[model samples]
Target: MDCNYIRGADLSHDSELNQKALAYHADPKPGKIAIRITKPFMTQSDLSLAYSPGVAAPCLEIRKNPDDVYRYTSKGNLVAVISNGTAVLGLGNLGALASKPVMEGKAILFKKFSDLDAYDIEVDETDIERFCDTVAAIAPTFGGINLEDIKAPECFEIERRLVERLDIPVMHDDQHGTAVISLAGIMNGCHITGRSMENLKVVIIGAGAAAISCARIYRFMGVKEIYMSDSKGLIHAGRNDLNPQKREFAASEGMTQKEAFENADVVVGLSAPGSFSLEEIALMAPNPIIFTLANPVPELFPEEVRAVRADAIIATGRSDYPNQVNNVLGFPFIFRGAMDVRAKTINMEMKVAASRALAALTQCEIPPYLEELYGTKLEFGKEYIIPKPFDKRLIVEVSASVAEAAVKSGVARIETFDLEAYRHTLAERLA
Candidate 1:
């Protein structure tokens, strides 16, 4: 008998990080997430109540009144992280099975950061209709659906169809998560520079999902002058070969790449590294806000940007840097609030509310522990424009803000919505 026997035990992968990651995933029971029973089943009575006799009572009650399902089951706290592997991180289209690890990681974040139970659903279909239908079919199983990592244009339609068809919260985290967090930083940056949202001229280096969503959310924040560039450069009226999403953000007068970046107040990079030249980024106005958000590699690094223009405020997707516009700062808590309020949809109002809530947290007194944890003094400055993901107050403040917006926007489904009481309940999750 072999003591260390396991499937593919002899097989190995290359690189130091690969080995460490492989062993970490394999030795930790093959996955990053697992489900746990919230109910007791220690005896025959417990079994009868959990399954056979007592379970029937809640089932009948739910059948009699459809909304009773939220009262009787875990659906109110459960979110499905659904994805098609078309655009899984920086590694594109690795297919459904390959995206499982990412989905599981997302589920774990949902649990650890916001106390939400999540199941990762990797759909094997890419056809927009089939994908949407599959997600819609399983929609009833979750209180909310977080659409993830599907390629753009298609993801837009998929989310649209599901949000229209289902009576639950639906959000494409790839789209709105970055949007929400980035907007928070933008809000703080503008305040620091004394720039008004309506007067800001924004240039986006990618026309993908996140960039489009950022443009949409910034519009809600009253940012009017937005120019987006795909692989073809600035999305402008002269381009006959533009998709609807790209066309919507197009500038009426086609401008040169230099013209687009020149005097721009903000620039966001959602594409790969070197998506724009240093000279291009250098063309921005004085004290410009630059977010090079491409993961693993940004369009331009902080040092590079600083060398060219020291006054420019910079943000990246990397955690090692200051003012990281991470999605973790948005999704879990956003869903937590939305589900608690039984929101019909995660509307623009809720998103803007969450962004403002996050921006506000940076100005609040920093927790003593965070300064010690990060080995740096944290405050509302150029270096600390957004709250850290581990901040205990996030689940309380962000969730409460989203809930209030949900209620005020007329999207909440529950009766007697109490914002103060809901804030208390959310705070207990940290306690």
Candidate 2:
């Protein structure tokens, strides 16, 4: 196949997809989501109950107990999708107003995937203290907070401050969402390739927010020897220009991209397209786990990887591929589980549980209904190490695991938890 022909076809397809997306968001109103009244409002009696005299009853009760706010209102099921627009998906520093569409899109996914209610809140403040203050002031309105599209370094500080100040589940989806989903796929890849987590050598091809988070999660999963790279080169302790976040993942030794890939068990590409060459990838161990998760264009294409090493387990951020370690597979279910338990925070335990749950799910018997949805037979293998985003069992398995983890970790406010019973409820949400 001619490379130019493929590039031309991809360009035309992208143009058509973008046009359709614009039309879809425009015709149905100027947004991808909207509020819907869930209660009766036709009669004067209903109006009174919805507000004024009758509403004061629940308000008074909530004021007395404080915790009764969850019982009286929708706070326990509501999440705020927040952003300052500095890192709007591939389009950087577009400002708050421009990130509304992406934020709204996040809210809708929460509703569609997990039966949670969400609102998009775009903060105009860029200063770290001001941004955190604004979000904390409005934090009471939601059971959880999803920080999105804010640039790194600032994002780290904002999330840290807000997490300490608020008593709800808080997550920066760009970091932890990518972490959980990719970790799940990598876990399965390790299982199938006869590799153990502790012994594996990892070369992460970016040192940005997502890349840093991925390194942390890999560490939690018992992976040592994680070598990360930034714009300059491999992140080693000798480098003087490293950010605080990048410095955390610094290796004791420096190596070329080629030397780093030599016998490496896994390589995660979260940087820009062509960040590393295919020749470097060919230096990896047999049956290497290759996750090139850069959106729109990966650091290395699946085809390009396959041409070099046929034993490699491949995944990309794109849905058109077999193993897509996409964030949509993580956030909704994670928040669903956390909010259900009234978790005070989305701790690393919950995140690790969610990723392990996803890995276990991939090896489960694929239901006929699920296979029918994608028009294919699904199985656990190198090609299908990650569960498809459309798999319905995610709500049950992943959510239950997250909730259980929250309870066990002592972050959940709920008095008691029944794992099986909770799984049943999650399944009912889908039904």
Candidate 3:
């Protein structure tokens, strides 16, 4: 049982797995997925109709009526994974070409799970107002606009203005996507821990776009006392050095983050690495729900926090760890629902409904395949507080909830579409 020998133990057993992994990621002769011809398998007539004089029929019709483009082209199923160079992951300001990889990854995920065709378009501007105008001008080319990895505050304004300008669903995926999944995890966490959202005192670290949006969404979901923190300290009511956005949440009476956490039922870390100190965690209310969602590294590790308080419901943003609150669980299904229903915008009600749907999905019995992935017997408990990304039911459930919300909110263009049939259609497309 020597720890030194552990690295060698059964390591080669994964040689096949490693080879398969390497095969899938094989040095990009640009990584495979090419578009080939589909349906009636391409005859001379098909070729002419798709490309030559025959194509002019649809072109002329579309030119007469621009809305006809949706009837003729792939734009109905196409989403543009758009971003500006200001914020690309934890690596900020990498420019348009540099952010293409993340956008391409989004495309692959869209195709893989939802069978929606998507592509990335990284614009070469940093100015928020200009970027907003640019996306608004080009909005017709896509069925949905997915703003990825853009920096906060600016991201907030850009998405707001674009959704206002465009008819299609415009979303800042980092903000709403992260919030949806986080809400899902928190919902399950609350149910398992026997805590209600109304009674919980939540402390969220990081006042970035995700933090702000999540805080607001948490408020919408019934949490009354939400204490958010940036690098300096607590975001309460009116602190002197606050930015316009931070001023809304600035501490009024000088209550520090520690004092805010003293009676907290949940501590959400959306800040930088190591922002959640052990001392800060020990001050939380009993059976606290802690979600350290900082990437690559969490604000605090699950094991480290559990050492301080064993009963805490701990989750992170990493798949290698248990209870991973991955944003992948939210966006694809969300867009799937929105696009299928031809929703005008991804509203807050839809977002909350999707979150509730996600939470509800986890409340059901765990799938057997999850045992290998989670490395634990999954059930309704602190350890199994959220569903894995591979859970197939998530797509249908969350999408239905979102679509229903869209209808209720009057954002949906298709008022009476069959959701069950649509879900089956997506399943067939993916199959």
Candidate 4:
């Protein structure tokens, strides 16, 4: 027998950091997430009770009464990350098979970060109503529904209809999740830079899910002066071909995007790569806040934008940058809070509360763990406007605020508890 065998793998002899990295990479298989038996040490009697004969009692009861599934099965702890492959990130529409990697990653993040058991559902159908019906029918299996990467306009209606049909919290993560984080970041950015939301004139590039949602959130925050644009220039109130989503956030009667940005206090770029130029961004008011949240490549590069306006506060979606308005800062924690109180739906009240919580965390005094991770104390300023995604305070501070909002808004199924005590428990768990 010809076999090439290693006698000993001395991984521990390597440098500590290298050993740690290697161990993490080698410990799990290619895709680390999978199902395993929860009650592994069951005896034959336990197996009979859990499986064949004794299990039939609950099964018969659940068959008679449908709502008992949440009591007997894992339905209450599970979420479905459903997607139709029309708008899959920067690499648009790779179909269901290719989109599985992203869906799987989302599932892992949901499980890892929020302690929610998530399963990815990639549908191949192109018809929006069919897909919506299919998902709505299967909604009983999950506590919540996280819709992802379905194309816009259609996505808006689909989400609306699903929420109407299902009793569970139905959200399109690409739309609502991105919007929640962007609003949170924007609130922090404005507060840090000493700008008032009511007086700020903002311009949003791209009238897609993220941009439209951001505009709506801003409007809900009482910022009336906002403008948005798409490929065909500004989405004004009178645009003949404007979709309903874009039309709701359209610019005033006679203003283009560039015109709105000419004296704007904030310019948010949710459009495609290289969409905003230095000259265009330079047209904004003094010390303007700019969030170029396009992934992989921002609408304007941070260094390039900084060259034009040195005092401007800048943020992006990439982790390499200082202020990353990444969805990681919001989604996991938002879902955590939502699930905790058994929220029937994600309403505007909950979203605004989450944003306020995130903003408040940044404005509050910096904690020791934050100082350690960031290598210094965080303050409300140009460079340190938002909390980093890895900040330990998120689960405690943000989730508690969100849960409180859920209770106050009357969407919570469970009774609310002491906010301080809840935060303390969350702090320990996160720590």
Cα RMSD of all models vs. native, in order, equals 6.1, 3.9, 6.2, 8.5
Alpha carbon lDDT at 196, candidate 4: 79
TM-score of 3: 0.90
Q: Kindly report which residue stretches of model 3 are placed more than 4 angstroms away from their true locations once superposed.
A: 1-28, 31-34, 39-43, 64-66, 372-376
Q: What TM-score would you give candidate 2 relative to the actual structure?
A: 0.95
Model 4: residues with Cα > 4 Å off, grouped in runs: 1-28, 60-68, 374-377, 415-421, 428-431
Q: How well does model 2 score by local distance difference test?
A: 0.88
lDDT of 2 by residue, 86-110 (tens): 8776555778998899999999899
Please provide, for model 4 over 241-355, each residue's C-alpha lDDT reduced to its tens digit, 9 standing for 90 to 100.
8877777876667776668789788888876666667888889898889899766557787999999999899998877777788776777777777766788888998888888
Model 1, 1-431: lDDT tens digits are 00111112212323565679789989948999877888997999999999998899999999999999989899999999999888777556768888899899899999998899999999999899999889999998999999998878788999899999999999999899999999999999999999999999999888878888999999988988998888777889999988898888889665876788999999988887677888987789999999998765677889999999899889999887999999999999999999999999999999999999999998999989989989998878888898998898999999999989999999998888877888889888868
In model 3, what lDDT does residue 356 have? 89
lDDT for each residue of candidate 3 in 226-341, tens digit (9 for 90 to 100): 88788777765656666676665555566888898896889888766667698988998888889998765577878899899997888998887788988888898899889878
TM-score of 1: 0.95
Per-candidate TM-score against the hidden true structure = 0.95, 0.95, 0.90, 0.88
What range of 10 consecutive residues in model 3 has the weakest lDDT sum? 1-10
Worst 10 residues of 1 by lDDT: 1-10
Cα-based lDDT at residue 23, candidate 1: 92
